[model samples]
Target: MHEFSLVKSLLRQVNEIAEQHGATCVEEVKIEIGPLTGVEKILVQEAFELLSPDLPGSDCRLTIIEVPLQAICNSCGKSIVVQNFQFQCTACGSSNIRITSGDAFRLLDVTIDTELTTGVTEP
Candidate 1:
């Protein structure tokens, strides 16, 4: 599944971030996945769970937030929230449309448990 590759990339980025901060373990990872991203949430989660132990961030949990696809109708000048893979405009039944969102697959944030030395000072 494509989700495997996607999760692989995501975990790689997480590993980089954790290493940058000298983290001992990753606590959580939050990501936003749009409907038009073509990545299935269930498959991604399964892949993450299956691969978490072997990665740098062991025992980390992945949280996915689904975003709705939106488009602007070219013919009717209407804003449409696409549902069920329908690209037609709701206002004038126009097929001409420009997608605005719902094609995003991005990592929002990562929470990590970093090692702290005794009385470490920050600049």
Candidate 2:
């Protein structure tokens, strides 16, 4: 599935960030996937779980946050919380709408463990 590719890319980026910070290991990875992005949660989770150990995210926990679609009705000028893929406006029953969010796949944050440095000189 394409989820594998996405996870691979995500891990690559995470590795880069961890390396830049002199991290010895990654603690956690937080990401948000919107409904419209078409990235299946189960597949992504599976991929991440299987691949995390081999990547820089060894012993890291992957958190996937599902984001709901938010849209605004163009005709009625009303905000709508879309559920069950319903694109129509509930207040005005209009199909003219613009999606404000929920169509994204983003890496929110990463926690890494850096080497413990001591200023004392070993004699």
Candidate 3:
């Protein structure tokens, strides 16, 4: 599944950051997922759980934040409101619209814990 790949990338980034900061274990990973990102939350979470142990951040927690779809009309240059997945500009009847947000899947932050003296060795 695509979710598995996405989670793998996220874990890799987190591990990289954790290593730079000398973190022994990752405690939490916050992610922002837009509604129009076309990714299922449950699937991503399941993938994260399945893949966590294999990565450096074994004990990390995944937190997902859902963002709404906001588009700007190219014709009228106004925000298009989404109701029931209907994306259309309120000010004008224009099909030419540019999506502004709600199509993003990214890691926001990573929280980690580590000992003061020893660094976490990569596995």
Q: How many collisions per candidate?
A: 0, 0, 0
**Clash list (residue pairs), candidate 3:** none
lDDT of 2 by residue, 1-123 (tens): 899999999999998898899888899999998989888999999999888996553678999888789899999999998889988998999999999888988999999877668765556
Give the residue spans of candidate 1 off by over 4 A: 74-78, 118-123
lDDT per model vs. reference = 0.88, 0.88, 0.82
Residue 109, candidate 2: alpha-carbon lDDT: 99
Total residue pair clashes for candidate 3 = 0
Which stretches of candidate 3 lie above 4 Å from their native place?
Answer: 55-58, 117-123
* TM-score for each of the candidates: 0.80, 0.84, 0.81
Over all chains combined, what TM-score does candidate 3 have?
Answer: 0.81
> In model 2, which residue pairs have backbone atoms overlapping below 3 Å?
none
Each prediction's RMSD over C-alphas, in Å, is 3.0, 3.6, 4.9
Q: Which candidate gets the maximum lDDT versus the true structure? A: 2
Q: Write down the worst ten-residue block by lDDT for model 3.
A: 114-123
Error of 1 at 28 (Å): 0.6
Query: Which of candidates 1 and 2 reaches a greater lDDT?
Result: 2
Query: Of models 1 and 3, which has the larger TM-score?
Result: 3
lDDT for 100 (candidate 1): 89
User: In model 2, what lDDT does residue 103 have?
Assistant: 90
